[model samples]
Target: MIKKVILLGMAVFMTGSIAMAQHGGPRGNKRGMAKDLTPAQLATLQTKKMTLALDLTAEQQSEVLRINTEDIEARQAEHEELKQMRLENDQSTNRAEAQFARQKARLDSKIARQEKLKEVLNAQQYAQWKKMNRHLERNRRQPPQ
Candidate 1:
């Protein structure tokens, strides 16, 4: 009986350690540098870059700033919502509802952004914007050297 009890305790400890290690025991993925910045700061930075890239007029700059602000706010809200969902459902695998909602939100945001950009940009600028966006997306998918 004494030997059996010691073995059971050892097994429990080993399992617990393994579980902790799998779930980012002491050094989980930290927030990236961009996440450390305020949403307003990020919006302003992105808007300025877009303005420079597209040679935006003052009116276009303001419009782009507004769109960037809305985009940043929505992204920040989604981040918080995802974090909350993770915390609440750590071991739950039934994520269909959450996944559906996330997908819908992403599509809705994309459509809204495209419409807003269409209204704000001339045809040539819109074409340039789309090309630049595709290039950025391609680069983003590539792993850093």
Candidate 2:
């Protein structure tokens, strides 16, 4: 009877550990994950980068902010609509295909917006911005110390 009880306890403990591991385990450090920036913080970052890169005037800054705000709203709406669609259906091949299409469309829209933003910059500013982006991309690819 004692041996059977010990075996049962071991089985329960093993099952619990497996279940926790499947769902990102207790050892995970969720606190170290990047937190989403607030809208104001995002606006500040955008304005600072645009001002530095494009030498944007007050009027130009306002226009850029308006464009960014519109883009963000549209993206958020698209995300919510996609989430609703996903919730309404169980996972299947068709849903997976639709999700991929939606993600591709989102990426294409972002690229188009980036191109439109380039149109707003002067030739010199655009050249400088491109160089800066290249530097940033290179730095991002390097291994962290």
Candidate 3:
């Protein structure tokens, strides 16, 4: 009877493990932002969020919306390019291709956004925006608890 109970418990444990493995992890289940939402909708959502965060004026909000639209389009293009790269099997398992110059384009894009934001926002708003960006970057880099 004890042996039967032990075997039953082992079978239940094995079944549970198989079920969880088949379900996959959060990262595997997640959809890309570009895939999940339209660019125009994304831009509008971002613009409204920025407006609330920065207390933007009507003119500032309109400018920010334009910027957000451009940003969303560019990001979508980048996403497509990345997908193409993956489809082409372009990424080599080499330190040369892995290190250096990889993030240069992304950083340049960020710098452009910073410059544009500086031109669009007042000093206080620009500072707040930078702080918010830093906070978001920090959160993105952190592992989930």
Candidate 4:
């Protein structure tokens, strides 16, 4: 009887462990963590991170925060607009055209953001920021172990 109880407990424990592992933590395994966040929240997080990484002054921090907030808002709006376009099922917009537009808009936003950062950050800081972004891109491309 004791051996049976021990075996039963082990099986239960193993099942629970497997269930939790498949559940992907408390949030249900969503891939993009930021997808559900508000633009303001995302912007604030990004600005704070940048401030910490770059040792920004008060003025620079405020400027960077404003830039981040605006960037986030723009991106959110673009995403919503694209979503609306998809929902409308407008055959007028071909897949290639939509993709091209999206790519162009994304690149434009990046260029504008880089230029704004260049204005706010000194040369050394800007170079450091570029390096940081490159490293992050590299890490994002690699498969997780």
Give candidate 1 regions above 4 Å deviation.
1-31, 90-93
Off by over 4 Å in 3: 1-34, 91-95, 98-102
Residue 101 CA error for candidate 1 (Å)? 2.5
Q: Per-residue CA lDDT of candidate 2, range 8-123, in tens?
A: 99999999999888656776534233136544456666667879777887877876777676676677678678777768765665866887998898889878777877877777
TM-score of each: 0.72, 0.55, 0.72, 0.80
Predicted candidate 3 versus true structure: per-residue lDDT over 33-117, tens digit per residue: 4468888888888889999999999999888888888887987787787777778887566646644454677788788878888
Per residue, candidate 1 scores C-alpha lDDT tens digits across 2-106 of: 999999999999998998777666554344657888888888999899888999999999998899989989989998988987888755655787689789999
What TM-score does model 1 achieve against the real structure?
Answer: 0.72
In terms of lDDT, the best-performing candidate is 4
- Could you tell me the C-alpha RMSD of candidate 2 in Å? 9.0
Give the candidate number with the greatest TM-score.
Answer: 4
Better of 1 and 2 by lDDT: 1
Worst 10 residues of 1 by lDDT: 24-33
Ranking 2 against 4 by TM-score, winner: 4
Poorest lDDT segment (10 consecutive residues) of candidate 4: 24-33
lDDT of candidate model 3 versus the reference = 0.82
